[model samples]
Target: MLKRVIQQFQLDVLATSEVEDSHSSTVYKCTLSNGENVYLKIPFTKLKYQRELEAYEILKGKVSIPEMINYWSGDEECPGAFLLSELKGKPLTSAAKPTTAFQVGVLHAKMHSTQPPSEQVLNGMKNEFPNWSHFIDQQFYSFAEDAKYILDERLYQKAIEKFERMKQQLPLSDGPSFIHMDFRPANIIVDNEQVSGVIDFESVRFGSTEVDFSKLYRDFLSYDSSLYSAYQRGYNSIRPLIDLEKVLPFYRFTDAFNSIGWCKRRGNQEHALFLEENLARLKKWLL
Candidate 1:
């Protein structure tokens, strides 16, 4: 398969190594004989391949997507693959000035500015819910059933009750926009406090921009409240601030619930306990 990709691209490779342990794809770093390097992502699933391939096409000239070097796909049983130029920079998590939340917000604002086209994959999906509250309620119940064995009944019931009460507070929104659902520090690349690139478009979707803000808040804001102001300043510089402050608490609750579900299923005692501790933090808003 590697030989086919290199031959298809008519490129000479010096060596290749597995660089990213992707859940749905195998990512390889190919250093060519001439010292130029490129990444090869071979999908283990059709859906992931289709999404990543199409995502790159849609995001081609609009954003900081990697340049496609070569590609192949559409086999029922065989994995699809593509080659891309390597994005230069260190991951924001470990980079200097990593806490520069302003940069993060600016990048997201830039992405959200590009509305998803009507025929975009995520826009085509017909996911329905009566309202945001119904969605949150369903989230709790959907995982609540499975959580019974994973969590102490008393703790589980407390969470359900708390989130149910928050249901009334769920805010309404205008419509969906293109966003990185997994918009976190790890997926961002930073150079000298500026974002050099945003990677991982597999989970790209047209959804409430708040869904992503919630993720950012949960993953970063909780750790540093200073980021809230910096991020807002940067984001608003691109577009006027909406009611993000008013609605963020509700989304934070939802984010916590999602984390709880993931931790429960992971069955890691430490992670589960962390969520239990998280409950204490959430009480500030949920209660």
Candidate 2:
């Protein structure tokens, strides 16, 4: 299908074509006749296509985000939708040193500062689950159920109880902001010690700033306390730190559950270790 699209579009050279990630998408790296490198991302679902397109449109020119060169809808010829863009630099893991947590902290802080046009912001908000609790209870809960065997059910239940209590104690703040809901090391591309590009905006949504921060810290920074401190320092440089005392437990709970889901879905053995480790960590923090 992609080969046919390349021929139809007059693409001269193809560099790479393969399944990119867990999502239902095929990514192709192609070199055009004009010698420009381009990337094509094909999505299996119409909802995914529309969401990704909307995110690309909103994020274009705002930061080092990919520029959409063209978009093709599903038709008799192509059963799925595809979007083409200039191929960005290599993934951070490939070309550069792992970004320091402080660097990610600064990047996220800057991202949160970004405000989209009023209508776009409103539309994004409408698409997101109303609150963090609902998102966790619905999305995270269902995912957790699949990996229940790997988790310590007693600890998990306690964490859930703690999460509910913390949710009630959440402090008031300025409402929602545009969030890269899945911001993590894997989704970023770095070159020359700087973030060259951000990819996979599928989880992009309007949500609490902390929710985005939780994803980054849990996935990466939590591995190193030094990194966590560095991230906090970088983030505090942009915006004042919120009183996270109330929400920390809930965030940790969400992180453990979400990681379990990822591991189970991917058939990852290390995920079991991660669950046990995070469960212990959460217990210590909560106690």
lDDT tens digits, residues 1-287, model 2?
Answer: 78766755566773655635435466777766677777777666665666677777776766567777667766665644454665345554422333455566666777676654576543322334355557656766776676575657786676567766766766664336667777866676665676666777656666566666665665666677676777788778877656555566566666765666666775666455755666566667555
Worst 10 residues of 2 by lDDT: 121-130
In terms of lDDT, which candidate is strongest? 1
Error in Å for residue 167 of model 2: 2.8
| Residue 279 lDDT, candidate 1, scale 0-100 | 55
Error of 1 at 73 (Å): 1.5
Per-candidate Cα lDDT values, in order, are 0.67, 0.63
* Clashes per model (N, Cα, C within 3 A): 0, 0
Give the alpha carbon lDDT tens digit for every residue of 218-249 in model 1.
65655765677778887887876568777777
